[model samples]
Structures are given as structure tokens and as C-alpha cells.
Target: MSDYFHNKRIVVTGGAGFLGAYILKGLQDRGCGHILVPRIEDYDLVRPADIERMYDDMQPDVVIHLAAVVGGIGANREHPGEFFYKNLMMGVQLIEQARLRGIEKFVAIGTICAYPKFTPVPFKEQDLWIGYPEETNAPYGLAKKMLLVQSQAYRQEYGFNSIFLLPVNLYGPGDNFSPASSHVIPALIKKCVDARDSGADHIECWGTGKASREFIYAADAAEGILLATERYNGPEPVNIGAGFEIAIKDLAEKIV
Candidate 1:
């Protein structure tokens, strides 16, 4: 509903990814025409030279750094090093590059997993440093959390207008449905649909289904990101969550 982004040259890394694709579509729908997307094949973000090449080519007004190695608890537990290395390199390289190029704005996407594992319900942004993250996701979460630190420091020393957004679990269409890579909602939807179609009496789920989570529809997350870009600019990271939490079992039942 806002035209603040009109004619802006926005470069969204990982534009082919699940969340990145939705953000790109939202920008297009809101009259943003000069949207530049660089997929992994186009540029390896972990490599500084590739990122430099992209900044030289695009020269965008804003850089939305959404590229990373993401997965559910299972995947994170299995690939800790890959999760840490890829995410850290991508965030560090991209933000530094954007700052060097004098980009007007840089939007870094953070995650709720950055909060401490024992963080109280309704996790606050200031609570990010209270304790360590959940063991399963510490590597991946900490990697992205570094962006928040970099953004703040850049703003302090370099006067760069970089902002970080922390979003909770996101789900919608265009999500990865593969069991190995998918998040809770899509994975459950796929499993439930398949099991129902196959006449299974019951399907088991992980973690007792009592662990609560907050999920935002992908479209809403995109809208929130754009809104933050236009109205909010500050050093501390802002949470873009739905403000409502649900038990995993309840979410699975809704899908069923």
C-alpha cells in the first residue's frame, strides 16, 4: 500500500530461495521495478570476489541479504560446519561489500533461533544475548546473529544505514516440501497429505509436539520487511514475528 520503494534499485541475494522469492514478488507487486536477483549459480556469496563482482554489476540502492544455509533442527544437527561456515561467510562478505560500495540501505534478515534456547516466551530483541542458543541450531543462528552486530557497528563507525530484521518460523506456498530440507509446517503438510492418501491410521512426529513456535505466512513476512525498510532505521535488530505462538501438535492438526 506504500509507494516508498518505487523506482528503487533493490538487490536481493538468494532471490531464488523460498523467503527471497516471496520478498522479490512483494517488491514487484508494490511497484518496485529495478529488482536485481543473484542466485547461487550466478554468484557464490561465500566467495568475496563473487560478491564484489555482483556489487560492481548491480550497483543497487539497497541490498537485502537473505542468502544463507537454513534447515530444521534435524538438518542443523547433521551439518553443523556447513551451516556455520556458509551463513557466516555470506553475511560477513555481503554486508562488508555493500558498505564498501556505499549502498544507501542494507537489510539483513535474522532468525528467532538466535535467541537463547531457554529464552522466555515472547522473546524480546534485547534478550538475544542472555544465553546460548539451542544446541541443534546454535551454529546457524549464531552465524546470522553476527549480522546484527555488524550492522550496529557499521552504523556507529561508518554511518551506514544497515538494519537487521529477525523473523520467526515462516511457512506458505513455494516452500520446500522435501522431508530432509523442509521446515515444520510444510513437512507436516506433506507427510499428513501423503499418509491420509495412503490410508495410514496414525503418523508419528518429533519432539513430543509440545514445543511451541511462532509462524508468519511468507507474504506477511515480506510485507513486514518492506515496512521496516521504509519506516524503521536503527542499530538494534527488530523482530518481525506474528506475536502469536502455537504448539506444534496444534499446527499439525490444523494442516490435517
Candidate 2:
């Protein structure tokens, strides 16, 4: 590890989250100190006043905006308005506040779901605005997509240094395994483990198990984020992926 971020104050909004924790670990490994993590219980990102106070207190050199209301299809469907409002408000407030505070660099994490549902396979960064996102995840996805737009605008107008990254479905340890809000990988792992423990012959999954998806380990995604922070300094968003795709059924089989 280099001293690039040594003793530099960094603030990760969702430091306790799955992907956020991995990103935090990467920053720590690079010698970062004075890391401030404000949990939702302590500070809600949706509130402008709280965000303003965080900027005043932490004064982070780099702000990684990862705090948001995230979940799978069922959760999104159940709480569409909350997902949209919380995520949109948090992102807009955090990035705008960071710009006003004159932060050195800002890293915004986008999602693949931001692309249109019918977008071409092997989705490219350019395909982001091709059409509407999938109904189940449109609100959550678009909320994050707005940050990319803000990044470009800020860079061009105010000369703010901000980069956006779109990472594919992420998994690994420390992932949320609750069936109500968990993503596919961890949910499947829990299900398989339980089924095997019960000696069940088979387990049933949703959606005909035909949809294809790309998966990235949480650690790998963090590496990509930091690498982009160090080497990539463009306004265009970069897609961090595993470079391979798999069907849902195939992925479950491999997990089992």
C-alpha cells in the first residue's frame, strides 16, 4: 500500500454496509486515517441539516456516497416511494454539499439497474439512458443514476472533481442474508444451507431462473473503486464487472 491516502481524512456515508465496508477496508489498507462513519441511527443522510453538519465536522478529503435504501425486487416493490425519496435526497444532498465544501475528489457508486430493462446484453456505460429501467428496480436505480448526471454537471460548470462507478451485482461474506431484502447470492446461500441441513431434495427459486446477471465480489468492487480514484479521473462513468455472465440457475448450482 502507498501513502497516497496516508493520514487523509475520508468519509464513507454507508461505511457499515456490505459494499461500503469493503470500500472502507481498501481505504484503510492504503493508510487512510481520520475516517468518519456516521450510521443511519446517528445521522440520516436524507436530512440536509445532518449532511451539512457532517461536512462541517468530518471535512473529509474524499467523500464516497454509498448510503442509500437498497434491496432486491420484493423490497423495492414494497417500498418504492421510500426507496426513491431516501436515495434521491441523500445523493443530491451529499454530492452538492461536498462540492460546496470544495472536497478534492468524490466517488459515486451507480448501479447496473440504472440501464433500460431492454438494454442490450453486456450493457455498456453509454447505454444508461437508452430507456426506462426495470419496473421493479427503476426508482432505486434512477436515484443513483442522478449522481452521474450531477457529477458531469459539477465537473463542467464548477470544475469539481468527481467520478462515478457502476458495479455489477456484488456478493461475498458480510452480505445481507435476510430473505426480505437480500440479493440473490447471499439469499441463495442461506436457502441452500438450510435446505441441506433439512435434507431436502430440491429448492425452488423465483422468475423461472432464466435471467442472466453479472456478479462481482465485494472486495473486487472496492479495488475497482479505489483504482478508479487513483488512475481514472474522467467524468464518464466506468463499469466494474467480473467480465463474465451466468444464468440464475447456473449461479445457484455453483453456490450449492
Model 1, position 115: C-alpha lDDT score: 91
Cα-based RMSD of candidate 1: 1.2
Stretches of candidate 2 above 4 Å error? none
- Residues 1-256, model 2: lDDT tens digits: 5576786788988899998889888988887877789887868889999999888988899887778798877899999999989989999889899999999999898898898998877888888898999999999999999999999999999999999999999998899999899999988988998899999988878988889899999999999988887778899989999877899989888988
TM-scores of the candidates are 0.97, 0.96
Model 1 agreement with the true structure over 1-256: per-residue lDDT tens digits: 8887897899998788898888988888889989999877878989999999988988899988888788876799899999999999999889998988889999999989899999888878888999999998999999999999999999999999999999899998899998887899988988998898999977779988899999999989988998898888888889998887999989888888
Task: Write down the RMSD of candidate 2 (Cα, Å).
Answer: 1.2
> Clash pairs of candidate 2?
none
Which portions of model 1 show Cα errors greater than 4 Å? none
Q: How many steric clashes between backbone atoms does each model show?
A: 0, 0
Consecutive 10-residue window with the lowest summed lDDT within model 1? 65-74
